[model samples]
Target: MTLPRMKLTDPKALRGYAHPLRMALLGLLRQQGPMTATRAAEQLGESVASCSFHLRQLAKYGLAERAPGADARERPWRATARATSWDDDSDDPQVRAATDELNAAQLALYTRQAEEFLARRIDEPTEWRAVTGFSDQSLYVTAEELAELTGRIDALLAEYDDRITDPSRRPDGFRRVSLIQLAVLSASPGGGPAPAASANPVEATPAAEPDAAR
Candidate 1:
């Protein structure tokens, strides 16, 4: 009810959540609704046993829980939160390390999803193709301004939280959209690689899908 977002601080909890399947499963449950392991396996093209095991693991870490109507023959699982939040700059070394691992895993998963979308981009409907593509922008702002900007973005996202949490409110043509926001403080000029020209841009290597499916 409080716009569920898990605020994780424990290194142990962070490490438990860094797994690819666990992250994906949480996303799926949040997007959809309560689902049995069999249903999740079917949607993900994975094994029911595997999903069941990971769902249990997620429950162990307080990321997920058994749904209210679940019974022995068909237990349903639901995400405890709509999203996860953590501070990247923790004072503890162990917390920082676990945060790094989770961040890296999320980045890898997102990159692979992006590559997969690109592979099928050409075949997508013309309207969607026209509206979808990468955009790059640079802005100079102070730390306070950056925090304010992120807060404004979160406020914007909150406007649509109801549509996400309640499937029935979704519009006819709308589908799930992933919004990724990455902000990094800039160093002095010449501190890092120079900006690329508009004509030619550096490309990142395509990421392979996580091994959790196997």
Candidate 2:
């Protein structure tokens, strides 16, 4: 099978995967390979109708798309992009809303997953050791500046994407979560918006579901 290429659009894609369930749907495809709406709904504990609606939304944003030969029937859908990252670059209100909502949901998902990972590790007595690395900071930058920073950070993290898989790197139970808490670090101290001071962690991966045992 051909690896899916990134088909993320400027704003439409952002709006598409903003919902909690929609993001979960994308993960279903990425982590488990292509799947039909019915299967996704079952895994997600959602109704087939709801899952099908979410799948259509994903397609609208050019994120996950139906298989090449898929018809109107419930067919497998594959993710177009492996991962997505963005910052407050555009001034358009609609796009910004879409982007911000997507970001909020995305961060929440990852945050929850991180918590679960720690809880599980604490309960289990496994050879794999627990590890933690995190950062929080303040910065003064405009949307443009933040966008540039986000890009640089993404490139840096992508470098380590396959490091763990390579036998040369030496395997360990070690895990890392890199979170970029970028928002208004000053005036809007309540974590204002995306173009604020962002701390880019180097070891973050797509959020993991809490129940790995499943």
Candidate 3:
């Protein structure tokens, strides 16, 4: 099946979609299908009123819409598309700025998810713990090569897209997984190592965990 997608070109729509909660709500609807504000609130641990407000905002930008409910008074919201996209290479300043904000919000979510998994991973199945963890690789490639690599990865992931919208297509042990891929330049252009650096540099220290859980 061809998955529906929402392509955001308007700066206003991009800005509106940049909120963390709104992004989370859209994700929930896409993964779990149609749901009322009350049900979405229960799943997201957010207020029903807040969910209602955000759902309306999403609808304004054509990201979501009201789905059929059991009765007239019961209204449910559904994501308009299974995937969202925007022009990362847009020359428009407003579009670029809005895209940056949206990217930051998305990265924050990914970081939180990784941290949460690390915090409770001990309780997970041994097989899962073995396979789930972070790894970074420094690749030496031209811009075109990098783009091709990412495209290949996207194509590989697309093989499983059908299972996302059709639960029956999933295997018995199937579970939801978030695979975050980031490819970017490692250093500034036309710049070399700092003069103060030693031949063998020490690894940077890791940041301390926050006192309170998010």
Candidate 4:
């Protein structure tokens, strides 16, 4: 069987989803499961008025959609998809610009989040550790080869995106894992690091149980 090729559509699905608040709104809904705009606002620490505005914007981008509810006014929202992957394409100027803008903003946000998370983790009483590791090897390949490697890395990262929420696994220190992958262009100047942990990941019991429980 032949596999279907995937390419971003015109105007690009990402263009509509690139705004900061809209992106944050999606993250909020996904992490918290589903909730009304008012509830989302409370969790986000934003005013209900502002949260309602962003939730609508999220629907506009097709990143989120209203959930079933008794009243139209009580409509809740949920994230549309588990993941979206994109890469550089210069043949179309519009695609190139949109992709570039989205990628840059994402990188900046990730770096800031990761730094803040690590900084705070140092002070927390919990038994958790932060680590960074890398693999380096020389390969003789064309540009396409390198790009293919990146695609694989992204798929791997996506696999771990939603499974890192188990808190009970925390004490063991390995029950949960957050995968952060980054591929860069050397010719073009780059941004910084990956996004940090549990600004508000879903609640799960820590990995290790209490002594009393055992």
- Superposed model 2: Cα runs more than 4 Å off: 1-12, 68-74, 125-129, 133-153, 162-184, 188-206, 209-214
Runs with alpha carbons beyond 4 Å of true place in candidate 3? 1-3, 190-214
Better model by lDDT, 2 or 4?
2
User: Between 1 and 2, whose TM-score is larger?
Assistant: 1
Model 3 Cα lDDT, one tens digit per residue, 1-214: 4447768889999889888778878888877778999998998789999999999999999988999999999999988887888878999898999989988887776677667667887787876665666655566677899889988988998898778767889998855667766665647765444334333222111112110011
Better of 2 and 3 by TM-score: 3
Provide the overall lDDT of each model, using Cα atoms, as 2-decimal numbers.
Answer: 0.73, 0.62, 0.75, 0.55
Q: Which ten residues in a row have the lowest lDDT in candidate 1?
A: 205-214
The stretch of ten residues in a row with the least summed lDDT in candidate 2 is: 205-214
TM-score per prediction, in order, is 0.83, 0.62, 0.86, 0.65
The residue ranges of model 4 lying beyond 4 angstroms of the native Cα positions read 1-8, 70-73, 124-127, 130-141, 151-177, 188-214
Estimate candidate 1's alpha-carbon lDDT, on a 0 to 1 scale.
Answer: 0.73
Error (Å) of candidate 1 at residue 71 is 5.1
Q: Ten consecutive residues with minimal summed lDDT in candidate 4? A: 205-214
Clashing pairs in 3: none
User: How displaced is residue 160 in candidate 4, in Å?
Assistant: 4.9
User: Considering TM-score, where higher is better, how would the candidates rank from best to worst?
Assistant: 3, 1, 4, 2
Task: Supply candidate 2's per-residue lDDT for 77.
Answer: 85
TM-score of 4: 0.65
What TM-score would you give candidate 2 relative to the actual structure? 0.62
Task: Give the TM-score (vs. native) of candidate 3.
Answer: 0.86
Ordered by lDDT, highest first, the candidates read 3, 1, 2, 4
